[model samples]
Target: MLHSRETYQPSPSFTQPEMITIILLYLLIALLASVVGSMAGLGGGIIIKPLLDFFNDYDLPTIGVLSAATVLAMATVSLIKLRISKVAIDRKNGFIIAFGSILGGFIGKWIFNFFVLEIGLEQLIGKIQASVLAILLLIIFIYIKFQKNMVTYQMKNKLGILLAGVLLGLIAAFLGIGGGPLNMALLIFFFSMDAKQASINSIYIIFFSQLSSLILVGTTTGFGSYDLSIIWYMILGGSIGGLIGSIFVQKLTSRRIERIFNIVIVIMILINIYNVVKG
Candidate 1:
């Protein structure tokens, strides 16, 4: 199924006007996703998958590749700006996790291939992944909306954090997200980082994981035929949005953004649930 040679050439049904509208709409959505996703420390990748699955005609593999690329664009802008601003980053640990993600991402691609080709569950896999992500995001959202005190753990579990990267990478490939939300949660809960620092770390975590996933996706998926224009739209939107979101987060404090983040997560959860049922 993944290796199907019957490609998507432009059809009369898939008209130029419709394509232009799609491009503009997706561009705006990606921009918003990156903006809020940056401030919220979720790296914008989480928002791309379910939304694209809902709206676009792209397949799961293409969706995954595009999601990773968009996240990469956003993360690149954010990280570069962070460097210019001289904000401190936990480089050593972040790189360690990224190193593990390299292998984990490849393994995840293999799993994705099996699911898509062997089991013929390409669309089903996306739906299942979206459903699980929605549930997890819902739990986090509920905790955020209701909990009075956010717990912060001591940063004593370096080895555990490093080991956790494997799962993060797997999820990065599986869900087409950079694992920003999960990384932020882990940092705050176990690494004793505040939401601000957690957001910073989450950006790097996303960078590494998404990079790995993108590399594996190209090789494994064999991007022979498909409209590549969708990718450029995502890149343009994600890049600009990432810069804006990074600046926004940096200018304002993360404490305020947390509430908005919770709300956004709830919205995404509802959207995912809808997609799951509809799919």
Candidate 2:
């Protein structure tokens, strides 16, 4: 069993060089993941969460917190870039969705705590998360592959949009993924947005949802037991990656973005599958 949150500390056995190497690795992962995630509207947590789980360096809660913080940074930077570029967002729907996401974030965190602290099934929860993520990724892959044949709606109902946001936030928070591809997929299907549009709006949604989730974590558990030394490195990487990705998104065609999104989905599915089996 993992140590309690009050007692757990990052392992201190690594030599100075080893610690530096690990920090560099963390930065690289955050950079790469954020770049691709920003381009594809994934918020990067989808990639970061699984990779961190694979590393087996920290407990699940710490990993979730770190991933959330990193993605929040990426989303914030990406959205700022978009705003500066004068990219228009659907403010009415966006704010409604964001509000719903805040509610869902709280509920999801509560559920996660229940499973980990009350049920005492940390390992089981990890495996379950991996398995579910893999399955969801597979479903998304198939949907995207055949989305050309699918019928999409341009929904304008405020209640429906709010509910959709809540669902997206709940899934993203519960899975510790920043609701990247899933957000894009929902936007495409429900909002009838094209690839580039979905990517931009998805980042907007991610910023609000991740920000709310992190606020909840900070005000409650306060990141006391986690190894937060590497967080600054990851945030820096995420910010740089977001800048690079925003530039690319502006240059790339929607078709190109969709292609990149498809490739990312495939890789994420494979990684989640590996995590599930390894667990």
Candidate 3:
């Protein structure tokens, strides 16, 4: 009973030419975001969301599709690299997170289409994302200030991992993130995992989440106005970036690398928050 004309909404910012330009720009952005994401466990989704929001006026559903696409592409590259290195993911935790994230992804897409989109909730979310990012940045700075040596500490807890995974699922669904920064924070704070382990595990988490989210998106709202032709471009760029990042990880000390990289993330989050609010 859905009327095609009734359901169709016009894009305010992205004309056909603009969209093509944005797609091309995304190829470069994907490379940079993937490298930083892989090296620091910061994630490409957060980077893409703001860009899409600023340039394309992408709604939440569109952000979800684009976010999922970025995660899928980047995770696939990371998965292949990890396989070559013989890294083993915590399968139990990954599966638990994936299960919850898949359900949340579906619910999130439904919520966007049925409610948020109609109510201009995407604009509201932009503000909230800014606030959340600011808070997260402050927390990171505080953690670094008070507990610089926490990197040497190890607090492995399987139960805690499961709980973090569930929370991550919810956050990812809401924010269009792959839950990398959130997961990285948990691994560093609660689990006390080192940078190398955290980075490797993050890729594992993204792999599962991406697989599940992709299916949810495909079955739900479909890819809103996406030109499927450029998927190969994203894949190619993301793979090269991921490979370079993984190599960079091996060259750096885990402690120094983690602390420095976390500082960068904290800064980026603050900037994103500022931009979203200013918009």
Candidate 4:
């Protein structure tokens, strides 16, 4: 079921100054998340979504929108920085994956709307998302921990690559995550990409998938009742974080980046698990 647009009114208890402070706090969180996300090629949304969910400041839909916007901003800036620094991406495979992600983005959003609006299961959806995310992160963490013993491939089949993108985008869009960890793991396993290469390509895939998802949201529900006041702050934080993270990626070795990725994944897993219980 489709719903009409509604404006979100701030709580009457929060004064103008208080609201500003709250927005600033969110900005700080976004900044920190973006830095870690960009450096590890996790696209920041994985961190942002669970943390925002923890605060319980906004509804699930609003949180999803905010996370998507911030991730898109971070990805844009990060890609630009990489380009300027002569970091080459696998454009053929990247674009193929991105095209598939766009299709997946559309389907994922439709499913989300169906559950949230049609079934009226917003809270349940949040819990489900958190639980699934936690489980997936745990699996990825385990895989990363013993990756040396696993058989990796150099997948060159375009159709397989496209299907992989679809699956990645579907999960990411549905969970309101930027699909960073999954992208990293899949890129490494299927394409035999090193950590640095996977990170760069992960951001590349995130940019297109997230952009498509946001476009679908805007075109269909027109932002619904999500808070817009903190959006500018999110953009500012994302841009700054993207710049800093890109520079760090350039300076750091692949081993160092993997260490950062592992640390962040563990932290995210804990946070998401808490969200599941709290929700």
> Which candidate leads in TM-score?
4
Error of 1 at 79 (Å): 0.3
What is the alpha-carbon lDDT for the whole of candidate 3? 0.65
Q: lDDT tens digits, residues 194-228, model 1?
A: 66777877888788788877776566555555455
How do all models score by TM-score?
0.90, 0.95, 0.82, 0.96
Q: Give the TM-score of candidate 4.
A: 0.96
Candidates ranked, most accurate by lDDT first: 4, 2, 1, 3
lDDT of 2: 0.85
**lDDT of the candidates, in the order given:** 0.76, 0.85, 0.65, 0.87
Candidate number with greatest lDDT = 4
| Candidate 4 clashes between residue pairs 3 or more apart in a chain or in different chains | none
Q: Candidate 2, 209: how far from true, in Å?
A: 0.8
Task: Give the candidates in order of TM-score, highest first.
Answer: 4, 2, 1, 3
Give lDDT: candidate 1, residue 232: 88
Off by over 4 Å in 3: 1-6, 10-20, 103-114, 144-160, 224-232
Instruction: Give lDDT tens digits, candidate 2, residues 1-279.
Output: 223566444434567897798799999999999999899888899999999999987778878888888898898898899899998787778788778887888788778867875676778889988999999888987887788899999888999988988888888888889888888888889888888998888889889989998888777667666677788999998999888888899999999999999998888888888998883
Model 4 scores what on Cα lDDT?
0.87
lDDT of 1 at 129: 84
Model 4, position 158, has a per-residue lDDT of 92
